[model samples]
Structures are given as C-alpha cells and as structure tokens.
Target: MAETVKKATRESFGEALCELAEQNKDIVVFDADLAAATKTSIFQKANPDRFFDCGIAEGNMMGVAAGMAAAGKIPVAASFAMFATGRAFEQIRNSIAYPKLNVKIAGSHAGISTGEDGATHQCIEDIAIMRAIPNMVVLNPADHWEMKAATKAAIEYNGPVYIRLGRLAIDSFNDPETYSFELGKGITLHEGNDVTVIASGLVVNEALKAVKVLEAEGISARLINIHTIKPIDRDIVIKAAQETGRIITVEEHNVVGGLADAVCEVVTAECPVKVTRIGVQDEFGYSGPAWELLDAFKLTQPHIAQVIRDVVNEK
Candidate 1:
C-alpha cells in the first residue's frame, strides 16, 4: 500500500490562499511578521502586490484588514493563533465581526500541537474567543483538502471568519477526490449505535483510528467530524445523541468552550445524551516535542480508543 501523505494545515492554508487568490482579484493578504512560520509567505510569493506584511502588530493588521474589507476587498489576516485571536480580540470583534465585514482570519500554529513554543504561543482558546463574537464564523479544518475547501468557502462567505490552522503535519484521513466541504455541516465518517465520537481539527484522524479500533473490538462507535465550530451541525449532533445515546467529543483544544462545548450545546438542547469530553483540561501547555505532547495530553489513538471503550461501557 502507498504511504499516506502528511501535511500541516498551516501549509494547506497558505497554499489555499494562493490558489484562491485567482478566483477573486480583490483577495488580499495581511501578515504579522511571521509569514514564513504561518506559511502566508506562499501567498506573498505568489501575489506580492496583494500581500501586505504588517510587521509584528497583529491588532494593527486586523484593523487594516477591517479597513480593507470596508474598502470592498477580501482581506485575509494571517498570524499565529494566539496573536491573531488573543492580541487582537478587540480589533477582530469591533472592526471585522461586529460589522460583519468580509475578512478571513487565518490563525496558524493553533492548539497544543504547536511544540516547543509552549503555552504562550499555543492557542487552544481561539475557538471560544472567536466564536463568542457576533458574525464571526469559526472553522477548524482537519486535513489538506478540508482546509483548501474551507479557504474557498470563507472567501466566498460574506462575513468575518476565523480558521484554526495546526502546526503538526498529520496523515490525511479524508480522500480529496470524494471529500465535500460544507459550511456548518459535520461529516459522519463512521456510523454505529453503541456510542458516538465527535471530533474536530488536529485530533480528528486520531478519533477515526479509535473508532476503527472499537469496531474491531465489537464495539460499534460512530464518528463525526465537526470542521466548523461556531455554526455547529446541530442535526448530526442531535441524531448521534438520539441514536447512539452517548457522545464523546475529542479535540486538540481545551474541554471548555471548544468542540465539546459546541456539541454539548446542541445535544443538551435537543437530545440530552451523556456526553464525555476528551481534550485539554483548561491547562497551559509546556515545551515538548509535538507528537510527544499529543501522547502526554492523551490526544492520540491509544488514549482515544480507551476513552471510547469507557464511554461505551457507561450504563
């Protein structure tokens, strides 16, 4: 069998920006002095005139992006997730999301997988922060194809968008030829009745592996991939909760106000199932190897599989 391709979503975001630039002449890019790291330099190289490096000022870059959006251009402001969502919360809320401007915020190096940079740079809270603002659409694409399609979708949507890009390069779980990307729709990767596993972002592939492992062990576990966090797929979540009677959310984010919270909001209102969350426990990350951190945080396949077993056994 051929080896599966592994690529970081940040690389995909940069490539997506470059590919989507030709679709609209008004598409422009703004960076915060970390183009090479964020991979926005790809767009910069492709469209130098349209790409603007706003130095290390993420907040100022957001303000400029808002201004550019007001001037009838589609601006994609790129930076590390922490700086993009944390340092520029006011600008993002007041300038872009509040007015519902056509600005796409690409927050690269998101979550605990941003190794060695530690907690200060890793941004697991960005989803919660961005989703709280009115008119801000939150997206956390799982793989290269999803990020590519999401980039196009964000550019096409007529409002502010915040997309989390992962630093770790992961194996592609979705097939590019058949995969479809829809805004606010979660994909059911596997269907079962014993329990449901809802996942997003960098940990999705791990969740899929866990589900497969459960299937082999005679446990029928459902798997749902929630790429869009803000406008979560309530229908799928409700159906999973109603049919499976249990839901376990997994993400490379904090258990609070992230994928788990979103799923809980849907199921709690609609189906009221027993929901278990597997993610960071509202704690700061430490410097370590990226993959090692995933294992330490219990975000890998083995831990996820065990969690699924435990959730399935819950009576």
Candidate 2:
C-alpha cells in the first residue's frame, strides 16, 4: 500500500468550503472568532465578502446562520465542537432545525483529539445532542478526503446538518479518487466474517489498525466507517449483527448517547447481538496530548484489538 498523507479534517473542510463556494454563490460562512483554529480562515481569505465573523458568541453566530439560511443562502456556521453544540444548541434546535433551514453547522476540534485543550474544550456529547434534533443530519468524517466529500454533500443537501471535524491530523485511509460520499450510508473498508468493527471520525483509523492486528491473529474483523451518524445506515448494522453475531463500536466520543447508543438502537430493533463499545467511559477528559488521551481512554489500536478479541471470545 502507498503511504497515505496526513491532514486535519478541518483543513479539508475549509478547503472544500472554498471550492464549493466558488460553484454555489448562495453559500455563506460564519465563524465565532475562531476562524484560524477551525480553518475557516481559508474560506474567509478566498471569499471575504461571503464570510462573517460573529465575534466570540457562538449562539449569535448560529442565529445569524439560521437567518441567512431562511433568506435562501446556504450558511455554514462553525466553531469549536463544545460551543457549537453545547453553547448554541437552542439556536440550532429552534432557529435552524425546527424550521428545517439549509444551514450547515461545522464543529471543529471535536473529541479528545483536541489535545491540551482539556475537558472544557473537548466535545464528547456533541453527537448525542445534534443527533437528537429533528431534521438534522449529523456527520463525522474520518479523514481529509472524507471530510471534503462530506462538506460538499452537506452544502448540496437541503436540510440542517451538523458536521464534526477534528484538529488532529490523521492518515488518509480512503482513496479520494474512488471513495464516494453518500448520506446515511456506511462504507465497509475491510470485509470479514468473525466480527464487525464500526467506527467514525478520528477513531476509524485506529479501528483499521486494530483490524489488521486481528487479521494477523486469525480473527476476521470487518471494518465499517460510519461518516453519517444520524440516519445511520440501519441495514449495514443489521447485516453485521446477523453475519458476525458480535460487533465492536469504536469512537472518540463518550460511550453514552453516541456511536454505541446509535448502534444498539439498530441492533435491538432488528437483530440483537453483543456489542462492545470502545470510547471514553462517561467521563470528562483532562488536559493532555491527543495520542496520550486516546491511549489513556482505551481508544488506541491495541485496546480496540483486545476488546474485539474479548467480544469474539464471549460470542
């Protein structure tokens, strides 16, 4: 395999926004004074007139985006995941989602990978919060290429969207030329029969690494990348449950109300199977290096592989 270049998803999102804006004149971007960190500066630089800096108020920025969307403009409001989802949730729920406006909420610096920003900045519950809103499409792209594709899709889709982006640069797993982005569809990266590993965002690469380890140990672990969390691909989850009998969910978010909850909801209704969730165990993160936090929270490749082995053994 060729060496994959590493890039942050936020960088790809910013670049994608610039490219999309060139094609769509109605696309406008709003930032809560974190343009540089969120990489929204790229769009601002490319299209100064279309970009709005709403200062440090995330709630106001969301409201502004909603207003823009209501007026027939495709507005993208972006900020840190914590503020984007937690601080301005009401605005998103009422001002955007309730009316089903065509606004894209891009939450950058998501998950424990925000490194050194601590629990206050890291957002483990954004997925749950955004997924709960009606008429909202939640997306968590795995890497640079996926982020670019997902961003373009979000702009084209005529509904409210919450896209989670990470600050940490990660290795590209999907080939940009061949990979296609479909809303609410799960992409199977590696096929297997012994067990299925469903992962999203930064943890998808870790899940891929774990699958390789399991493969060497004679465990056929299927890897599924779920970029679209809301309206999650139910058919894929059910098929995995029936074919594998055991599933492991890996994510960088809290185990509660996130990927684990989403997966269990599908399996319980259709096919009941033992599902092992690997993620932050309902605890707040502390200040630390991103990789260190991932290891401490038991979200690294080794931990995921061990969990898969344990789940398979239990089955």
Candidate 3:
C-alpha cells in the first residue's frame, strides 16, 4: 500500500508471521522443508525458537501442527500449495478441520502462475479442496496489505484457516491506512448497473483494470473483490446478482470448483443470475513463464476486458 509497491504475497505471509510473533508468544511456525521457498525462512530467521522444520513430509508437518494446536499453541503449517492442500489433504481434513483446531495452514505458490513448476506443482484446485472441509476458513489475499491483514485475521481467529499465497510479484492495490478487511465480506471497488465482475486472489487486480477499460468504452460494470471464499459475502453477491443481473467471476484457480462455483452457488439459491467464469479450464498447466501462462489462459487485463465486452454485447 505504499506508492505502487510490488511484492509476492508469500513474502508478506512470512513477514507477517514474524512480526506478529513479537506480540504473541503462542504463535509457532512449522515448515515442510520449504522455509526458503514458502518464505517461512523470514520467520525462522527471527523466531528460531518458535519455528520448527518438519523435513519434506507435508502430512507429518500438518499432523505436528495439529498436535501443537491441541496443546494450546497457535501453530502455522507452511508448504507449497500442492503438498499443503493436495498431498496432505486427508490429514488436514481429519486432524485439523474435524475438531476445529486453531491451526493456520499457509499454502504458498498457488495457481497456474506458479511458473516453471508446471502442472504438478501449480495448485489450481486448492480453493475447492480446502473449502470442502467444514470449519476451515479459506483466504486468498490479493496484495501485500491484504495478505498482511488476512494473516493477522487468521491468527486471531480461533479456528482452522487456509491462507493462499501467490508466487508472482503483484502490485499493491489496497491502501493500508484506508483499507479494512472483513473476514467474510466482499469489498465493492466500483459500482455499476450493467454487469458485475466478482474476482478473487491474484486476478482481482486484472479485473479492476478491466473494469476501468470497460467504463471508458461506455460499459458500466461493477467490481467486487472477494478475498474470503468459504464464507463468501452472500449479501453482496445477492445484491450484485439482483441489481447487475449478470456476473463474471475471475480467479487464478480452476473454474470448476473455485471462485466461479462459489459465486454461482450464491446466486443459484439466492437471486438467480447469469454467470460466466474466467479461469483455468479443466486442464493442467504446462511449464512456462508466469505472465505468459496467465495471458495464454486469458487471465490478464485485456483478456478480462474482452470477456466483459463479449458478455455485455451478448445481451
């Protein structure tokens, strides 16, 4: 939130953990041999006594975090998105989410933008995977300030939480002094009556850019940023559906069960509205440059604006 600063959300995750540890002694961090990549090394550098490295075993690391949580410690388990939400999903579902333990799971390098890591490493289905677990709070912060605030929110909340962090360095959009992050509420960045664009995670910035472009072209599309997916802001979504009449969802995740499905679920039962989704199709991402892969998948500002244009014209 400082003059168009650019930073990876994972970097914010680490620094937030370390800084928050200063005031809270119960905060303990566990890394799955990815201290450097997940950026938990930032916390390890300062809070060595409170940080634990659990080798490369993500499942074991989650189990240990659960145990620590059971002992009344605020344990945070860190790992790549693939391992944290994919490989160790069963443990997370049964151990942490079942009893609603106060454990924070930080899944870094999420989505197709994870770059050269390829399909195997890029986790585009983590939102679906984690949101399916009851009692789990799923958070996908858009920028540095949001990530910092979201991390603090997850820590202060006494329940299981899944915080998604991106590997791509994105520009900060929200101002720290003026921005306030509500757990389950969506922030309406721009309001219009034509159509609403509800976006989450890394693609929110692109959606904002597209909203401005569409307005310049005489289209009036509303922009809403949904950072919390599990308990998505139903009232905001319902109002947008009822007012705008149409909605477009964008995310850096799979369209099948990610943000698209979440938005559809709200309108399906609340206020039926037509919805179009923009995200990775039901296919694996191949190895490529991060920005190029996003462009190829049509997740950039121009592509988003084009989608908005097409959706509007279809009326």
Candidate 4:
C-alpha cells in the first residue's frame, strides 16, 4: 500500500487505473475525447495499443465498450460523469447492465467538481440514476486508498460496474498498514451514540472532520464511509440507526435517490430513527469552484455538523 495521500478522486482513479493496466493485460482503457483532462493519459501512454480515444461520443463509446467486454476484454471506459450517466444511460442499461457485461464505467469530474462547466456538466443525479438500474454495481470511494482498492475490486468483479470519481482531491483516511478494502462492506471510522454520519466520496472526509469537531463539543459521532452505493452496506446503517438515535446522511449528490435515500429506505423499514440529510437539494449546480459549490449546497463540514446537532436535538 502507498503512504501518499491524494488531493482529488480523479487523480486517484488515474493512478490506480495505470497500475491495474500494468498488472492485467486484459485491462484496456477507452476515453471519450478527454484523456488528458480526465488523467487517463497516463494509462494511454503506458499501454498505447490497449487504449482507445473514442472522441466525445460517450454513448457510442459505451456501446463499443460493451462489445469489447463481450469479446472477453475488460474495458474501463472514461468520460465526463454527466455524459457517461446522463446521455449514455440507455446503452448502459440495455447493453451493459442487462447482459451484465464485464465493463467498468469509470467516470471522472463527477458532482459539482466539473466547476465552471456549470450545471450542464455536473452529475448530481448520477448516483440515483446508476443505483436504480438493476444489475449495475455502483461505487463511490471516500479517498485514495479506497479508490485504488475499489478500482482493483471492480476490475476483478464479474459484472458492469460504475465507479464515480470526483475532480476534488481528498485526504487519505485509512491507515495504509492495516486497512483493506471489501466490496459491499461499510467501515465505521468512529463509534458514537449521539449520532451517525453516513457519507461517501470527498464528503466522507468532510464528515470525518466534522466528527472531530463534534467530539470537541461532547457529541459522540459515528462515521460510516459508504464506499459502495448500490449494494449499500444496509446492515451497518441499520445497526448504526439501532444504536444511535439520530442519523445524518451526507454526500456530494442530491439528497434524493442517493446515499441518504438509500440509507433511509433501509433504516425506515428495518429500524426507524431520526434521520437528516446533508447534500445538494433537488436542483442543478452552477459554475463555481468545487468548495464554493459545496458550500452553496450546504454539503460543507460545518453544515453537516449543524445538521447533526439539529437532528440530535429534535425530540
């Protein structure tokens, strides 16, 4: 395991994809005309023959990737998160998810990080869209370590997988010496009785930071980093809800149909608890820096802490 921490999820994905391509000859890459921007250029430089630049046609690229996967090649397709999930959804559903093709849809510049590109490019509905599709594996890693491990796991897992990558870099959370990745399993960063914060992607790092702030104020906060959004770690969430009377779900996506919604669906049916969601409200994002966008949507650390405090105080 590497000890270095990353600043952005897309960079983490780029580094991990290059490493995977070196180890697996069948691991091929396809970029929809944004290799340099998406950082897949590293893999393209290392394995020229195994890399394909499919221009800006994400839909066509998806169909081609499905074809390649059907031919026994492990195709990892890259594109803007918006186009990958928004424009190419039908192909992803019928061609990839339906047949359960061995394709890894590694989308970069997800969420509000495609800053300045505005709402037209930001993928706020990606998680909800991807997770709703049957037979598709959805992953939203918290940091660099989880990204690398999840990348490897997605490559080995036998099915169509959608791994969301953010443009904003996040600090490494797990201790390299001990932490190991597990698919569909949740990791509890802190054990608390007052509240539990279930988060994914860069927001997980933020929630962990908020937990420290909460601890200083005498609030014991439990942090659950949900790396897999599709096969969500419902057991861990239900257990947390059972123990912690209040729960706060956080993410870099819309509050509806994403991690928060998923957790609520599980907890409300299995073990009802006080739940508050911290994320982009149901709306499109505008052009701005990533942090500004997060702040605008109330997905910041302080906002999460405030939500936790409010939810805990309620009833």
Clashing pairs in 1: none
Can you give the TM-score per candidate against the true fold? 0.98, 0.98, 0.99, 0.97
lDDT of 3 by residue, 37-65 (tens): 99999999998999999998999999999
Sort every candidate by lDDT, greatest first: 3, 2, 1, 4
List ranges where model 3 is wrong by over 4 Å. none
Which residue pairs of candidate 4 clash? 7-169, 7-170, 8-169
Clashing pairs in 3: none
lDDT (0-100) at residue 312 of candidate 1? Answer: 76
Candidate 1 clash total?
Answer: 0
Clash counts for all predictions: 0, 0, 0, 3
Off by over 4 Å in 1: 1-3
Model 3 residue 215 CA deviation in Å: 1.2
lDDT of 2 by residue, 1-315 (tens): 435869999999999999999889999999999999999999999999999999999999999998888899999999999999999999999999999999999999999999899999999999999999999999999988899999999999999999999999989988876888999999999999999999999999999999998899899999999999999999999999999888899999999999999999999999998888888899999999999999999989999999888887772
Which of candidates 1 and 4 is the stronger one according to TM-score?
1
Q: In model 4, which runs have C-alpha deviations exceeding 4 angstroms?
A: 1-4
lDDT per residue (tens digit) for residues 149-170 in model 1: 9999999999999999999998
